[model samples]
Target: MPPPPPTHADPPVLVIRPDSARTLGLAGDLWAFRDLLWSLADRDLRLRYRQTALGVAWVLLQPVLGALIFTFVFGVVAGLPSDGVPYFLFTFASLAGWALFAGILTRASGSLVQNSPLIAKVWFPRAVLPASTLPAALIDFLIALLLLGGMMAWAEVAPGIAILTVPLWVLALAMLALGLGLIGSALMVSYRDVQHILPVGVQLLLYASPVAYSASNVPERFLALYYLNPLAPLLEGLRASLLGTPMPPTNTIVWGATVALGTFVLGAAVFRRLERRFADVI
Candidate 1:
């Protein structure tokens, strides 16, 4: 027995290693874990409907309710113009885009904290948490769009060639929401105040955005600063797409996309940098 013990292999190298240096290759990592992303997203969609009687109908309901209120206030009382489009149709179109962007940002910002347990135990890429909300929000957007189509048909307003730009406009909105969401989610782990403030912040943003009114309402002098709000071009573009109103100038849309991309990049970098601390802090 003693002689057999002496023939053992090299002490099973107990290499004490520090955490492997993880570079946040967001695109590469995200592509690699596409299945995880889909799973998380499906979970979110399911949770969104869990225990709810109306289920996904809530998606169609939200924008419609908001549109009714805004139409009464802005159209009936304030007498805002809808650029020859019916006020109901005009407001509904704008609501579809605004709701999607705002909903994505709101849900995404809270995604990390909401899934704290998963974050603590999982070795998956953290970005997937926030990105998962996008698809659910996009589903809500499409459902709302169906309602918008009904409104359009009722009003007999046919979307022209300008409608082709809707995809580009939606891409810009998604980028903007992702950037804001990433920043919010990162900040939220360390500072819980963000959770309380996000709803109020989004509420204020709704009025500031051209969801109820038109960008044309802004005086020429303020147009420069007005366009600075990324939602400005997106909401306007949506309205134009549905109602054939004037599109945000190409330059403005380009500038908005640039800002959106910049925000997303900055947010991703900050999120990755802060993510190492999340498990400990959250």
Candidate 2:
């Protein structure tokens, strides 16, 4: 047999630059760095449960604890309607949906600051910091959903064919939360003040939302403004699909989705504009 010619490697390419390019190419940037995003997400998920005794159980515990507290406060103490479902299941279902949104927003909002050392030492899409939070939050959400499925079975609630549509609702909520998170992260990089107020704002928004209570509780006069919250229709639709609660009007979901998309564009703009100075300030 004759020996084959040796293969040669291609030369590496390198360059230096002074002024940075300004363009709205975040999607392309994120696509290019998809591996980095998955690595960061996997690292976060590991670190999250590394030393914990309960590990992934904490994901189930948090919403369970919250649901218990809410059931006591709203179901027993304050008297809230659950639309014929047990209060715990009702609140848990609602809370489960909200948790996904809240978790993503919280993580993404702080991603830049949390990864400050990496941002300083390395070069990647700054957008990836916020982008990576989605997968981790999604993992948490899926675990929580398993618990929710059990709760639904306990409550004798059955999800119908409509269950197929749940992802669309979740997508709308994710888009909205991510949009806010990106904007908050950009602002957080410049002004640490956002960190101080972001949790409080999230808490306020949680309570202001229909988590423990029913969306029907909102008066007709304020209904218009309530649906304007973007989360309103998404949460309502989620509850409807999962727990069989009354669905929000189709218009509400459509409007909220449109608003979410617009908000995402605005957030991306703000993120890109402020991204250049991240290493300097962060």
lDDT of 1 by residue, 1-282 (tens): 355552212234434345543443787667767788898899888888899999877877888898999899999999998788888888888888988899889989999999999989976778889998989989888888888888788778899888888877788888889889999999999899999999999999988898888898889999988998888987898789877998888888878889888988998888887877788999
TM-score of each: 0.90, 0.91
Q: What is the C-alpha lDDT of each candidate?
A: 0.85, 0.85
RMSD of 2: 4.0
Candidate 1 lands at a TM-score of: 0.90
Each prediction's total of clashing residue pairs, residues at least 3 apart in sequence or on different chains, is: 0, 0
TM-score leader: 2
Worst 10 residues of 1 by lDDT: 6-15
